[model samples]
Target: MCVSAALLLLAAVSRVTVAVTLPPHTYQTPYHAQVWSCREVLATLMEQELLGCSFTIISVHDDFSAALTPFLVALMITHSRPYQVVSVGGGDDVRPAWHSTSCDVYVIVAKRLLVLSDLLDTDDDSWDWQGRYLMFTSSSSANDLQRLAVTYKLQKTTDVLFFIRGTSDSELAVYTHKMYSKRSLKLLTLWRDGGFVKMVDLFPNKVNDLRGQQVRVLAVNHAPSVFSIIDHLGLLHNVSGLDVKVVQGLGRALNFTPVFHDPGADLWGSILPNGTATGMVGQVHTDDSEMGIGNVFLTEVRARYITFTVPFDFERACFITPAPRPLPTWMAVSFPFTLNVWILLVGSVLGLTVLVPVFGAGLMVRDYQELHSLSASFLLILAQFSNQSTRRPARTPMQVLVGFIMMCGFVVSVFYSSNLTAFMMVRAVEQPYTSIRQIVQSELQVGGYSDFWLAIFQGSANQDVRSLSQKFFRFDNVTKFLQSIISRQGVLLENTKHLEYLQKTFLTNRVGESSVRLMLEECINPFGVGVMLKRNSPLKSSADTMIQRMREAGLVDKFFKEVLQEARGPATQLSSNTDVGAEGINPLTLQHIQGVFLVLGGGMCAAMLVLVTEKAVAAGKYCL
Candidate 1:
């Protein structure tokens, strides 16, 4: 009887177990059964070409997203790329670090469509939506797909793919858009066909041609980079420069129209202390301008705000200051000989004056009475040195001494005359500051129109650059900065090419000589110059490709030379007399010989004073 009870209890337990397992087998949802297949479709999508090797999965805290995150991460790991899964409770809870970390592709899975939209539509620059994005949502309907398309279009997110899950897990709709266009979403294909997943090219060349669309460009009136000609009405008439030519070439190649806008007072913008950008950079940063062109340099700080194309040209930063003034004209008398030579000449004359009297006394020459007194000896020696003959001495020893003096005088006179003539013809100038170190050591205030130039060197590891940054000044008013340079009160820092252009165009005298001169030493090594575009601009790849082709074909350098030639016009010929010889020798003017007359007038005045003093003393003695 106990064995029979045990069998009945075992049968009851078996029936309960069968009832629990039968429901899962009979009412299983297609979604639960085909999750692995959905993963396979995702893996195929990820196999498409990407921008980099980093992968990111962004999802909200929901059952659908949480369940899918592991599968996406597994695929990324299997593909051997760096991967990160970011889980957020809501759109507003997204971390700031996620915005800065660059990823080649982002896989976003959300339970609700609103959550995905909220995450993408964050109204801040902290999150730069660069690279490819693929989105998946459990709320898949025709309207949901359309809403996703609109969201991407509104955000201008071009490199994106949308996966629309249908009622049956086997079917998924894939959609994307052509960049820089206002078209409806393009259907690449459904993910599954006849139980097999089909592969589609997620990212393609959509920006090859912009189809005559207007591209807004921010530009400044910086010469050789960009030149703007305005009419009397203050309207822009035309624009041309090396940078303009490049943009025009791009427009032609890519079939787009470039509409330029001036940043008004911003010019080439700078980053403020508050981390906001101004001018051309600000426009690009805020998406107000598609591109900024005016010899924009590629820097790490700037790269954070905007994207730069491949380098089209190179330039070195240089310091320009007023040209050194000519030395004082009154000092020309001493230009023929150095200080040591003048001292030696005076010493020789005095020595002859003393020795003549001493030698005459020692020789006991009866006919050498002129050399017996100091005054007589001095007059005789002075006459011989002046290349003038006086009464001859009858003594052989005195004649021999006079002949030697004449020979020495002739040699000295010839050298002095030649050097003096040269000095009179050419004006000597003061030594200029040739290097950054010299300018730093000088009292001249070093400055520029923009603080951007100063900021470039502020973080340098080089000691000299660090020292330069400490003394650097910034001027908001360009006119004032230029006036300071012209007035010789400050040194202006700028690019070498622009400085040269300024020297040729504006900073020149009426005679066509440059008023400002560039320092021999550069403030910084040559760096690359490129076009500035908003971060992750659609036109970057195409622009870079076209620029690379132009550089390789030597067209960039050709454009640079052509723009320079056009801006400079005819070469300036310094005014000169045709009577000058082939060696360019100039004749002496009154400006040169005034020093000699000054010395003569002073000597005559001294003589008159001495005569008056003698007469007065004689009168006083008579009275006494």
Candidate 2:
């Protein structure tokens, strides 16, 4: 009895059915069952159902989750509604994760069809139930008449077209009258209990909606947008960029197949001395390719050469630089002012020494003998400037003047002390080249792909732009740029959109965000992003219309947001602590102020040497 119950449990768990042909041979009976992936079967049923429709797919197969790639590729090609696929089953409730796709077709698979209908659809008695669905069994339909009845009870009163296998023509005729479709597929493939081969054609290719229209597209193997998408359907195609979504969107709108061309090293087309176009733009200009689309910036110069559709994005051209390292802890002593300011303060002290003694000594010379002597007068003046007193001079006009000199000394002492405290209490944020002038003045070199920035800078009227043209070094390729950017070897000029995306995806993973920053104020020629095309290409208008529809439908923003969300692969968020201290003031240690002490030590040594030399000279004079 336990063994019999175990067989029933196994059949229930695997969504299979079993039956015994004869009571004596029951133990030897085979369980012939058929299974289908809901995604493929449903997509086939509603071939054009997903066209212009946003969709969601739910799969119960945990092992073969990648089966959704074909449907995802279709969405990419059509630029239809943004969609997602999720796995459900294994004792987990898969209810709350269900969100509406809005104008959607929900493709769901479970052990039975009723579970999906309850999750997705509202009952409509008038809806057609003819050939929209299929449920096939192997050679077990005959002896397992009770199992067939159980399946019917689960899928009762539904409009989904059914394809059921029957034992023979006599039994099939009986099954046909049961379902709304009255349709029954014979057990031809299972003739003499044969293996499953050439079992089904998901898409028979009977419909020819496209009549063979073709388009040539310019592409670079950029990631998360247009690169290479491979699927089990033997489809290995490129345009692996989310930016190239427009091409597919337009292709579907205009009914054409896109043929992509690679521009090799040059992404933006350049003008050779021979006056020929080369690069992605070049292909579009010469009609070698119909349109170029893949995160390419639209510029006035390119517009002059060829043509560009109205922009779908606003982007800027800016330079990327490595973030500055932390300032030395010992340097905090002189942090308030430059070395030149220290020199000027010392000179002021000397000037006041001479002037105060000379001006005040004459009037006091008559009253005090200490003031009458030049050396004594000098000492008295020095005491006032030093904010000290050897003897209180007479309260006379000249002495008053000396007192005033002492007050100036107090001001200097307070100023120096205050500045030193401020320096010791705070940190120096090492932001090198925050603005354009700063970048031009810094030793850090500016660089970018020559073909991209040179044209804009060369033709610009702004003096700053023209001056910047003189400073750029040409970048040869992406490999060198990636290495140099993190190491502080070079500052690269690139579009802010692509640069930001690259950081969120690639560079941040390797070098980290602590080492780099994009300078926006230093940006030049902020432009709109658009598809490149020939000067008088007829497809431009249609492409522009499709792009405008995406904008109107808010898909462009949603597409990029989805790309960023999906590509978030263990990227760490940049820490604010890297820039600012925990308490806002990073306390200075001896290391932070070491340079200040070093300069003072050198000054003391020089003074001691000079004093010793003067004493030696005096002793020599005494011997003479």
Range of the 10 consecutive residues with the lowest summed lDDT in candidate 1 = 1-10
What TM-score do all the candidates reach, one by one? 0.68, 0.50
Best by lDDT: 1
lDDT (CA) per prediction: 0.71, 0.54
Candidate 2 displacement at residue 319 in angstroms: 2.3
Q: Please identify model 2 stretches exceeding 4 Å from their true place.
A: 1-217, 221-266, 271-276, 285-290, 300-306, 322-331, 338-344, 364-415, 425-446, 457-476, 485-489, 500-523, 534-587
* Clash count list over all predictions: 0, 18
lDDT of 1 at 337: 86
For residues 87-120, what per-residue lDDT tens digits would candidate 1 score against the true structure?
Answer: 6673244442443344466777776756555555
Q: Give lDDT tens digits, candidate 2, residues 1-624.
A: 001110001112223222212221222212212122222233443454434444444454422233333333343233433455545444443342333333444444333433333333322222221112233222323323233333422223222222234343112111211221113122322211222223543322211222335556777655444565544542336444567676777767766677666665666668788877788777766556667776677766577678888888777888777767767766676676677976876676566556655555556345555655555765665565446766766647766766676787677667767887776665565756577777666666678765567778778787777667777788666666766766767787777766666666655533344446777766887788778876655455567777899889988788777777666675543322244455666655576568778888988998899999999999999999
Count backbone overlaps in model 2: 18
